[model samples]
Target: MNQTLHAIAPEKGRKNKSTQDDVVYAHIFDAILEQRLAPGTKLNEESLGEIFGVSRTIIRRALSRLGHEQVVVLRPNRGAVVASPTIEEARQIVFARRIVEKAVTELVIDNAEDSQIDKLNQLVLEEQECFSRGDRGAGIRLSGEFHLQMAEMADNPPLLSFQRSLVSQCSLIIAQFESGAKSHCSYDEHFELIDAIKKRDKSKAVRLMMHHLDHVEKKLSLDDDNASDDLKAVFSNVRGKK
Candidate 1:
């Protein structure tokens, strides 16, 4: 792993009960999404506790939560590691995302306020800036957040929660099976979807969202033989150090 992987630290501020666990979980989850932590990389509890300035108990809690979400695997006596999703799981995730996101885009068209639309546009702008700066990891994270933000704007908490999980899983799948060196989400497609929503063109928004997801799915090399390997070399800079 890269040395930067050791840079998982809690934010500087007040601490509350279980906040440490949340911080640790977010760090690991973000690392996975950013491809800094490869699938099947062993998540040593003691090492993580040291890295995040937390206790082993807290690390265990965080790992357990990730396991529950199927983002990591917890093995008997083997501790935890990042989840290596199968090709079937990957397909299912993309399918679920299309269903949920189509609903979300339609709902946003129906219910979004001007301010919410503005906020989404701002996020896309920031995402474009990240891409322009060659910050692929930041761009990828921001791209996923854009979808989550849209789900929030849909004003359906249950669906929003589901989208969050699905998006996170998609991040892992992309990291594992993405083909070539292309970006995951197209900025132009996102812009078009936002425009459709802004115009309250429900049919267009739904159509654009589905097509956008299809484009994303088509970028994965799910059949690659080496796709199952733990790509530690790709993220060799990530060291679970403090």
Candidate 2:
């Protein structure tokens, strides 16, 4: 769980007015984030409908929404598949990530409060626990969340919402583009980023985050590797024992 934005899914027992299509949308979207569905993977309507216990209509609706979000692609005669973003698109994703998160990091420090810093510390502790237990899922989820929680630190509701979307989309890109699910902060760089924030060292935090994103971009194997499925098998071996 290197990035954790999707972990805070809609409450388990609370319907909250969302439709079944929306539920499938979230589930599949999270699956992409978790790299359970590699980019460019075929998504058959009947198979998805069966898996999700929904009709083709509902699956279509969900796929349509994901298409709008740039997470899934629908082509003429090709139907639907997980979006295999190009290197150009990957660069744009990194650019968008830097702009959105840098702004939030600045805001986090400017509007710093004792409680938010305290919460960040608590989050980091839980992050460490996940690390010790070798729970990559938690690390992945928490990595993304480190930025979203920073948005909360800023106390800007609208910007927070937008940042949340940006991070969600970023997760999809990382899932596809990066050769491995292992994130840039495996050494707890996020802890240092937030520590700088808590100390009100705005400049340092911004620089750290920028460097982190750049490192992440560099880790991407965006060369002649067009076969996502085989590459995903390589990534899935990150911690698996033979």
Candidate 3:
């Protein structure tokens, strides 16, 4: 445990509480996933301690958890850094997602009720608002939230855990995408998904889910026309200091 992690919660009962650690973990995790903390970005104990108002001990513990989840890396003698996913890693992540998400949608439609469908419809509205406001960060989160919402609908703990991993890896790939824009899976498709779910059309929901993930993959890969260096620079420049 790094000494700095403790300072963030000096109040009595706050320092030992895991709730604070969860907060620190989520804050840093969101920063990395949203591209605010880029690949290879060094998570200096001092800096994170200041940002989250926690001790280095707490930050290290949180980072250790991220590494276990493949979200962050702990380099020997180098402390913690954001995971710099390779091109091959990105491809595998999306491919795995295509399979898992398709099946997850099938499960959702199998078990979901009208009220759950309504909740998802409401979420899509919130997603559109985020996009309209240029809150790509919020929009992307909402885009992914759809899958999580579906997972909750399915109520399969083991599969939900797997989906969580897939979501994290997908976030890494999204962070490396050429532009910091929301995905191109137009909002209408979300409406279609809700309508299909409302109609209890499981196969249609599965098909729509497959197509949605496909669109996500294609958007990430659309820059075959651009120089790899240009795209790499897009990620590298916005990333952390050497």
Best by the lDDT measure? 1
Q: Of models 2 and 3, which has the larger TM-score?
A: 3
Q: Report, for every candidate in turn, its global Cα lDDT versus the true structure.
A: 0.74, 0.69, 0.67
Sort the candidates on TM-score, descending order: 1, 3, 2
Runs of candidate 2 exceeding 4 Å displacement: 1-19, 74-78, 180-187, 222-242
Q: Deviation in angstroms for 97 in model 3?
A: 1.2
lDDT of each residue in 105-175, candidate 1, tens digit only: 88899899999999889878877887787776667667777888898899998888788778778867876
Predicted candidate 3 versus true structure: per-residue lDDT over 151-240, tens digit per residue: 778888777778877776676567566352644454668889888888889888888877877776666642322222122243443234
Candidate 1 lDDT for residue 240: 55
Candidate 1 lDDT trough over 10 residues, lowest sum: 1-10
Tell me which residue pairs clash in candidate 3: 2-57, 4-55, 4-56, 5-55, 5-56, 5-57, 5-58, 6-55, 8-53, 8-54
lDDT of 1 at 97: 92
Model 3 earns a TM-score of 0.78
Instruction: Return the TM-score for each candidate structure.
Output: 0.81, 0.75, 0.78
The residue-level lDDT of candidate 1 at 130 comes to 77
Residue 150 error, candidate 3, Å? 0.2
Query: What CA root-mean-square deviation does each model show from the true structure?
Result: 5.2, 5.9, 7.9
